[model samples]
Target: HKHLVQALRKAPQTAAVGFRQTVQKLAIVVELLLGDIPERAIFRQAPLRKALAPYFQLTQAVRLGNLQRFGEVLENFGPQFRTDHTFTLILRLRQNVIKTAIRSIGLSYSRISPKDIARKLGLDSAEDAEFIVAKAIRDGVIEATLDPEKG
Candidate 1:
């Protein structure tokens, strides 16, 4: 707590740095408190779940697929939040899923075949993946080329 206070004092104007630092400190505290407890025992503690609800709420805000909203949530509540490994994995997976969806639709980065895109995006339905691709094309976010013979 003393170190956090000192850090906050050192950079009073930078919200990003301050938020990250505070979250890291909170994570450390949580890890220390729950590290030795069995998973079953930890889950049985209803108060712990209640206390962590705000963190989960913020995570859901981040996963809403908007960078601005994510940044705002981080800036607003990051200081009071701590997340476990499961949450971290969920966040990472969400990011990857979005990236894959974007790239699969050919609206981001490199171009890829539709089949490959569907696989990368983990879409069970090729038609659904094609819908995404078609939407990107319609929105002028991506362009498709035809072979000379096909054209």
Candidate 2:
């Protein structure tokens, strides 16, 4: 667990890959913890869903780039969050989508035209797709730029 936390702090360049690996490690830890308990006794123990609240909160803070809040969430609720499946899935989905979007957009940020995004995502029109793209940029999911030459 200490090693996992340390790795997360290092901020590897492959953020998505690193994040997924961290989650897998954490899941392993949770499984190990529950291994000794009888299957029937599991429910009688603290609800796994309740235990994960803190972790999910921390993950949200991290995604928003609020380092201070992220640290605080980890410090306060990290243990419980590790055990929660719902929170873990939410974070996993968020990470996966961001990674997929980044890979879809190539070298030229300006090359990612609104039409391209909309068509790829199967949206009704470019305008609707652009709206979603704009929102993603605002949310820090991806960066966008306009090139005078392309225009």
Candidate 3:
């Protein structure tokens, strides 16, 4: 990704129009690669940052476990995501968002029912919440046990 960014930056002025078009698509890919990093140097480029605002917003939503905002970002930027070949990758982050929510819930409460988790995370069913929580525990994202009969 850095190589691509450097190549784009070094492109000749004669290819300014092509550079602009490529930057539109490349910015999101770069943003995705840099999302978890603390010092994201990409944002320093004002035009690239402007182009990547929606992708940046999506990352923020994932980090915060804001499912509603996540959905909104996906809806708003679906075309851009598809064009940049990142739609599937972005979709996969849904689980991360759920796990983040689970971690928050685990920190806040010692005991929480799957039904309550379903409601809190906007999941379709308690069974779904159970599965997500079980995965989170298995993956070491959280430490919790699901008492099927109880929660």
lDDT of 3 at 83: 78
Q: Could you report the Cα RMSD, in angstroms, for every candidate shown?
A: 13.5, 14.5, 3.7
Q: lDDT for model 1, please.
A: 0.46
Model 2 Cα lDDT, one tens digit per residue, 1-116: 45654654564545565364445446433432332111323222233334434444544553443434545665676455555433453344333333344434633354767677
Model 2 spans > 4 angstroms off = 1-99, 106-109, 146-151
The runs of at least 3 residues in candidate 1 whose Cα sits more than 4 Å from the true structure, single-residue gaps closed, are 1-10, 13-113, 145-151
Q: Worst lDDT window (10 residues) for model 3? A: 31-40
**Model 2 weakest lDDT span, ten residues long:** 35-44
- TM-score, per-candidate, Cα-based: 0.30, 0.32, 0.76
Model 2 residue 112 CA deviation (Å) reads: 3.6
Encode model 1's per-residue lDDT on 1-151: one tens digit a residue.
Answer: 4564455456645455435444443543333233211123332334345554544444443334343454455566555443433334333433433433454345554545555656666667656556766665565545764222321
Per-residue lDDT of model 3, residues 54-88, tens digit only: 66777677778878888999999999889777788
In model 3, what lDDT does residue 53 have?
70
What range of 10 consecutive residues in model 1 has the weakest lDDT sum?
34-43
